[model samples]
Target chain A: MGLKEFCFKKSLWVFHLSAGSCNNCDIEILDLLTPRYDIERFGMKLVGSIRHADVLLVTGIVTNKTKSRVLEIYSQASKPVLVIAIGACPCTGGIFTSSYNFAGPLDKVIPVDAYIPGCPPKPEAMLAGVVKLLKSKNRE
Target chain B: MGKKTIVPIGPYHPLLEEPEFFKLYCDGEKVVDMEWETGYNHRGIEKICESKTFEQVFYVVERICGICSTSHPFAYANAVESIPGVEIPVRAKLIRSIVGELERVHSHLLWVGLAGHFLGYNTVFMWAWKYREPILDMFEIITGNRNSYAMFTIGGVRRDISEENADKLLKVLMDAKKKISLLTGAVMDDPVIHARLKGVAVLTAKDIHDFGAIGPTARASGVDIDIRRDDPYAAYEMVDWKVITAKEGDIFAKAEVRLMEMFESISIIKQCLELLKKENKGDIKVKVKEIPPGIGIGRAEAPRGEVFHFVKSDGSNSPVRHKIRAPSYNCITTFRRSCIGGTISDAAIATAAVDPCYCCTERMTQVYDIKTGKKMMNAAELIKLSQKKTEEIRAKGDKND
Candidate 1:
């Protein structure tokens, strides 16, 4: 196996990017770390810096102010980064799609490796999305 | 301006859930002053609400914050209900209080967890969040979702508290209360928590009034102003719970008020459930055939503070203009009082003490030396600085022991 694959096949560190979310998904991501779900068992953890990440979990519908920043961060990530869009807002601008500043459905702005769908996807759904993406399994 | 380093806290950060910016000007270890700004998460929600019908506005308002999902819609519903010749069913009113109080219990626990995490007390964070899960589970059981419970509608609630589920809710609440009290007792008795939080970032009543602050931020200062008790909306007037307040406006006092209020919320929900059981069979909504032209103002006490919504209708299906004043609009300014004259280490926790819910605190904030204009610190490093200080203090205490 390649060095990159060897390094990330077992452990995944994610950097969270909120283009412009309502914070439901953001808190849910934190919930994934809390004891109830304990996603740490899966060897997936949220890191503060994008440079240390193998996966980029993006939340929220992209507002105009955040769109450029989202693009910048996505570009800065190392190649072989998996971008998973969390929540309906980031997936298709959700309810705020009609709003003037709403510039999202994340894939429109940047390539997405996975999409976890929900107003705010449950922590389980988010975990499943990540696992699926790692295997290059499903697309929805 | 002689020689101050800017400890920038945002634009984006994993540590800070909200995506906003705070430029803390520091003279040595002390924060001399600071400037805060937000707008990164502004989706023009109020502007968008104008296009949707009055009936559809609740779903839109529900997205304001995942933590306080019911607050905005609750306020908006009251605004719509306030339109002349509108009256909701009695059962609906009780349901509103049940949901509101449940929200308080969950939010306070969430804050407690985050506060503990910031203070480097990982165990406390873990314990608090573990207790918080049952509350979310109850929400999921009752409303079919955990975060944003879309129970509120213009005329009344969309769902009814069935006789069977009411008993289930009460059972879940008791389990939550037991766990929460255990957490609260642990938090209250902890000496390290007392040292770190007591008298840290004291915002006096005068400072509170000057900043127009509300909710726990104000109540912690002994400012007895709760929209629930004062305005008497929904089933608040019918309930027997008293507002929890403290004389000192420090972080500890804020923590105390929030912890104490969780019990009050539990009590309120219990009372509402009992009342619902007694007078259980009633309409959950009053069908408003049409909305007449006029302006209506409504306020609901969110977990953060008073959520105010003003709706202007012009004899149409959709509102002409809908104005919302989130509690953060008032409470966020209070940071001017809290952050100034404090150590840079105390800065993050101090700002978080008010629970500003700043939407713009969303991205990776680039910190600079300000003078050299070169990147000096990332968000994690700054948060680490705060956690490190707490650890040092704890280590010294251990040495003294």
Candidate 2:
């Protein structure tokens, strides 16, 4: 593996972006950090700034109000940032698809490297999805 | 007056779990004014509910706040049931109360952990979240999901808590009570915590009344208003427990009220479980044929405060209009009262003290001009200021020893 790819695989700094979600998916994502799941063990951590992020973890069905902000953040992140949509909402618009504010199935808004689809996917599912995404990128 | 600086917190910031914007107009270190802009998280849940059938709306409303997931469903069920005046079975009432109380315990633990994190005390954050897992495990055993349980339905609940599950839940609760007691003692006795939180953001009883804050926010100020106790919905009246109130109305009182309320929630769940034993297992829901044209209002006490839902049915499969009033609507506004004149450091916890849920609070967003047009500090830096103060307090306490 190249040095750049090796470093990316070793430590992934994730920046969480909420694009008009119900907060269930957001809580599940936070749950991944707590003692039980402890994503930090794998050297993955949630960063406060998008500039330092290697993985852009987006939750919620991208709403009209947050659409521009989502795009702006995605553009601001350094290149090769893997975008992962973390709930049924962002993956397929979920139940709020018909709402006037609905602005996404996420992949249409930005390229999503992984999609973990649950109303709010379990923390176990989130961890597995991240690992799978990293492995696939390594193969590339 | 010192030169003013505008600190824009978010439409997307690390301190807030969801997107909402706050402009803190600070004069040097103390905040002189504050303005809020929401709607970033708004998916128009009420509008979405109008398109779904009465039965399907329960699932939609349950997502209003993941932290207080059951509270919205409980209120929505109460509203829909009241339209036909359909009384649910005893078992369902107990089950609903059980789910609500369990959500309260988990939500309060979540707030405590986040509060600790904001104050830069990662140990308290880790410990509180560690104890919270078993409660989530109990939720999974009973309702099948850790966050959104989806237990409530129109006339009653979607699932039944069997005898075996009840016994398991009881065992977990018994163990939880002891761990939480230890946590409570640590928080109450810590000199640093006392120095940080006590008298930080003092809100008077009149301020709570004027803002119409409900739940623990109001109770902390000795307002003595809880929807579950005042209105007495579901099995809240059937159970034996007292409302936890404190007269201080400071950040410490709010934390104290939430921590103590978890104990009452445990007691209520135990009583509900005992009552559930007397009822038949299958008698969980009452089948309602049709809805006559009518309007109904339902209110339930969420962990943060009261959740109010108004359902206007036109004798149709779906309600014509569904209006939701989450407690954060009233509680969030009180930031104007509590935050003003406090240092920017105290403002962080004061705003969070209400346990504000943006998903529950967002209904509309408006564009506003930033007159200063300068971003001095972000949410992370603001949180750092709060943590720095806590560190300073700890240092002083250690020197005293």
Candidate 3:
């Protein structure tokens, strides 16, 4: 692997973008930092700034209000950023698909490298999804 | 007068986990006024509930606030059931209380952890969350999902808590109670925590009454209002427990009320478990034929506060109209009263002290003036201001020693 790819695999700084979620997925994302799941063990940390993020972790269904913000954030992030959609909402709009404000099945809005599907995906499932995403990226 | 500066937090900020915007109108370091803009997380849940059948509405409401997922369903069920004049079985009521109380325990712990994190105390955040896992595990054992339990149904509950599961949950709750007590003692005795949080963001009972705030926020200010006790829904009336209240309506009092409420939640759960043992199993749900055309309102005490659900039915499977009023709707608004005159540093915790759930309350966005929008301060700077204040307090405390 190239030095850049090696570094990316070793430490993934993820920026969590809540695109209009019920806060379930967001809590699960926070759960990763807690002692039980502790994603930091894998050298993955949730960063505050999108510009510093290697992976843009998007949660919730994209509403009309958050759509432009999501687009702007995605564009602002440095290139080679992997976009992962967490929860059923972003992946396929979940139950809120028919809502008046519904504006996404996120892949249509922007590129998604991985989709972690659940009403709110379990922390274990999220960890596995990220690990698999990294392994796939290593292959490329 | 100091120059006015507008500090904007969210739509996408580190401090807020949800997508809502806040405009802090500051005169130098002190916040003179505040404005909030929501609608980013609005999924049109009430409108969507109209399209789904009564059975399906439960799941939709479950996602309204993932932290208090069961509370929405609890209130929705109460509303829908009242429309049909259907009374759920005793066993179901006990199970409902168990689920609701367990949610309260976890949700309050979540707020405590986040409050600690807001104050730059990561140790309290980690400790609070670590103890919260057992409650989540109990939820998984009872309702299948850790976050959205989906246990509530129109007339009863979807799942029955078995004898073995109740025993396991009881064991976990006992252990959790012990650990939480230890954590609570540490927080209550910590000089640094007291220095940072005590007397910060003080709100009065009149302020809570004016804002119509409920739950711990109102209770912290000595406003004796809890829907669970007032309206007495589910097993809240069935069990023996008292509402936790504090006279001082400040950030520290809010934390104290939430932490102590966890103990009450544990007690309620334990009592419900004992009650569940006496009740017969598999008598959880009742089959309802059709709803008579009528309007019914239901209210439940969520972790943060009261959750109200209004259902209008027309003798059909689906409700014609559904309106939900989450606690954060009223609780968050009180930021106007609590935050003003407080330093920009204290404003962060003051806003968060309500445990505002944006998904439950989002309805509109802020209108930005093009001229002044470019000079907005972000959430990171606000957090730094908060941490800097905490450090100053710590240094002051050290000097006093």
> Which structure among the candidates has the greatest DockQ?
3
The candidate 2 chain A region of ten consecutive residues with least summed lDDT is: A1-10
Candidates' C-alpha lDDT: 0.86, 0.90, 0.88
lDDT of 2 by residue, B259-353 (tens): 99999999999999999988855589888999789999999999989899999999999999999999999999899999999999888899999
i-RMSD per candidate, Å: 1.6, 0.9, 0.7
- Candidate 1, residues B240-330: lDDT per residue as tens digits? 9899999999999999999999999999999999888777679999888888899889999999899988999999999998888888788
Candidate 3: lDDT of B29?
90
- Runs of candidate 3 with Cα error greater than 4 angstroms are A2-4, B363-401
Question: What interface Cα RMSD is found for model 1?
Answer: 1.6
Worst 10 residues of 1 chain B by lDDT: B359-368
* Most accurate candidate by lDDT: 2
Q: Compute the lDDT for candidate 2.
A: 0.90
